[model samples]
Target: MGIIQNIKKNIIAKAMDKRKAANPFNPEYSDNFQLPPDAAEDQNNSHYFSVHDLKSRQSLYMRLALRGGSAPTEVWFVYRDGDGTVYMNERDHISKGESIPAAVECVEGGKKLRFTYTGPVKKGRLTDKGYVPDGNSGDTMVELDGNFSGLTDTFEFSRHMATEPVARALSREKFTKEFRAALSEHHQVHYEQSGTVTGSLKLGNREIVFDKLPAFRDHSYGKRDWNYFDRYVWLVGLLENGDFIHNSLIRYPAVTEIQAGFYKTGGKTLCVKNCTSMDELPVTGGVPEKFSYTVAYEDGSVRRVSCSLDFTVPFVFGGGTYFVNEGVSDFTVDGIKGRGITEFAFNADSSRWTRK
Candidate 1:
């Protein structure tokens, strides 16, 4: 099953690359909110930004998802300290506009995107015994003001990544009402860029300042219903040699899945043809472990990326149905040092993490 599926995946990936070359990703999408054709149903638009202050071994992250229907708009902010303490702030009910996302204050379209948070934070740390919380942090207000400025042209996952595997699996699977619901949760288009984030973060009066630190930004828009997914894992990081790497494996119900990612180095960006053992990547909360991945490029050439988790910030959204566990990581590819994040997501209600 894996062999045949992988063959088809490669073929589809090749076609995707051709289509992408012909249709060059539009720049306007970097800051624009686009609604899918099924606009009346479960459409959603979201923006994510992350910057690792390597010097301090800390980071600040933001995610804002605007959804259709009674689903509330979400604005989440996370700050990770050098000592591994995680501070999180989130608002589930917020007013948003048709073309404007709430909480993400845009200074300029793709060039500079700004985000801020002003609220009490929940403090926690994943330790040897398990997760330890500070009991709501007792009125501790966390404030953040940060902006991301792009360092490269945006990469469109829709164009370069393979979605045919999922489409083909869905075509053959019985589309029960449950399957349709799961399909609705998929995000059809995704855009991202490597950049720098600069701003200031305050935790009760002790302030940490950010000044042009290496970062990453992502924008995804389409219909999304979190109830459909089982789990997902992705890693994005920047090398000292000015290279950036991103790869993800998203799993859904009944053998449906998608693998998408690219590598940018030596002034060229290449699509990853396949990744090995992604389904087996461990997601653990104890002692901050590490993992390595072997990825084959379009030419079938492979490279090893060793990633180690330095610290993580965990967040739950979608009314307790979804969780995104993100970590600041140190990555080494061919002996070059890099730093960024690795995200592990779960449908909490149906996840092993929750069961444990």
Candidate 2:
């Protein structure tokens, strides 16, 4: 009897593996995936900044975080080329109050990469318009010395959702009210647009300069555990024709949340009132291959957009998966073409690919 039971279990396990390998994107198999034991809840804040230069055919991304749990403050940097090749680095500190390191340098084989913050804006530099990284300068990949200026007003979520009943329900903890107030008062969760990026990026020892590059920055605070959301999608893009767009969508087990970003054009930036997005997931990896979205503004105008993946960097963090894609995009407003970055994250135990 014992031998017969062991045989049956072996056959069942093999069958499950085969099924997962055949259709890794199917959500039905997600139950078989497992999260690490350390995947606990936490309250934290993070800031993410990025730049994409079409002329140089290179993209740069950086992130800094103030953790609320056992984890310490951390920083991450990544540089990618048009061909999907990527070079990345990360650092962590034991103190949350510590500032972002002035420089990050990495060397591999015969290649070298360095990131330096030339003029970093101090914390709590909030103005009446919003938080701005005015006069901020940085160098990425040893070649690009980015000087960002002319930052637009900070964009935030609607007061009704961010402060009123909705926020209360979402943050139903012992200090719910105080937490929400701090999130806003400290400018913990906000995004801003920059009108210009003057710098140069290097590709294979060749230096490419740009007089103007559109850019954006965002910060978030509060409970930011990756396991808190089952899935998330973040997209930001800038066109050569002077148009910019940003959007974020988060899915919890019981509810879906959306934060429509600002659209800037013709020296004007307006918050997007409504957005609808459809993503096509790859069959084997659970990564997004294409995305389509429509943005509607208060003025009754809509813009349709589509993006196709060109370069990809897959990242795994705290039992979650992040597929970061740098690609070319198109907008229906003027058929404008541009390049930018998009990120999709999924909980490790809930992601379809984990079952495989």
Candidate 3:
């Protein structure tokens, strides 16, 4: 069995070597990214953006879902610090702009985007369970004026995972669940990029100006049905060494952990070969307050990253069947200080979440 496993591993490794070259990550990952055939009317298209400033320990996180339903879009925003949130968007509302009031307005094909929002928000307070709005504080008119300029080229997760299917075919053991589930989840183009956000965010009398604050964003489109998901963990960070790490681990029923994203440094991006955790993550009141993981890069380099979450933007939506534990945290890689964001989601119907 050991010998058989080794052979399978070797085969997958070789296939992956060829895979990277054949589907090499784009240097700029800009204008080249193409939307799906049904993007014009896709019901599950989504664009998410987050900006983190290490100096101020402040961050901006927003998600815009374009489904063209009664709501037309599902949008949410959270602005916060170590102490608590300044303001957060509505639990439900229809947008006036084309999209969440220009969540990702294209400025330069793929190099830059206009990230702005002018709307009402509730002031969320930190609590033992997580963030909850202080109802006493009425809707606060908050404005976020920002720009996202690509610092590293964009990367599509599926582009770098060409070995999964081939590995399942060659392996001695059959793991149809993993190979099939992971592929089904990412059947569409979903790309992630790290950039610099420049602009100012105004909430009430206070204002925070960002001068090229490192930011992270991802563009995903397709059928985004929360009912189909089990649970997943995602991490995106900018290290002081000028390296960028954006990776994800997904778990579906009867499936294993499927990996995606890359480790970028010195202008090169390498797909993650494997991701593992040494111990159980710290979950405070059902939210992962901290996470530590080790990743082996395709280039044969391994690195470990740990994050201490400052706050979590908690929300129970999707007909009360989904919970997104979106956490903005301070990340550290090998003692190099940095910051990033993490989103751990749970689907209520999944046995995993129910058992917990």
Candidate numbers, best TM-score first, in rank order: 3, 1, 2
Q: In order, what lDDT does every prediction score?
A: 0.71, 0.49, 0.69
Model 3, residue 128: C-alpha shift (Å) = 6.8
User: Which segments of candidate 3 are over 4 A away from where they belong?
Assistant: 1-42, 68-72, 81-83, 92-102, 127-132, 161-186, 277-285, 353-356
- In angstroms, give how far residue 314 of model 3 lies from its true place: 1.7
Report the CA-based lDDT of candidate 3 relative to the real structure.
0.69
Candidate 3 C-alpha lDDT tens digits along 1-356? 47776687677668567766786555344333444434533346667888877777777877766664443567778888646665787654454354455355767755787767888788877776666678788877778888888888777665655464335333534446776465555465578788888998777787878898878788876656565566777788877777888777665544444566688888988777667731245433344666688888767888888887777776665667777777777889878888888777877765654222
Q: Report lDDT (Cα) of residue 128, candidate 1.
A: 65
Task: Give the CA lDDT, 0 to 100, for residue 223 in model 2.
Answer: 55
Please give the distance, in angstroms, between residue 180's alpha carbon in candidate 3 and its true position after superposition. Answer: 5.1
TM-score of each: 0.79, 0.59, 0.80
Candidate 3 Cα deviation (angstroms), residue 256? 2.3
Sort all candidates by lDDT, best to worst.
1, 3, 2
lDDT per residue for candidate 1 within 120-199, as digits (tens), equals 77787758644466774665687788888988878877665545543444454454677666554564677889988888
Residue 76, candidate 1: C-alpha displacement in angstroms: 1.7
- lDDT, candidate 1, at 114: 83
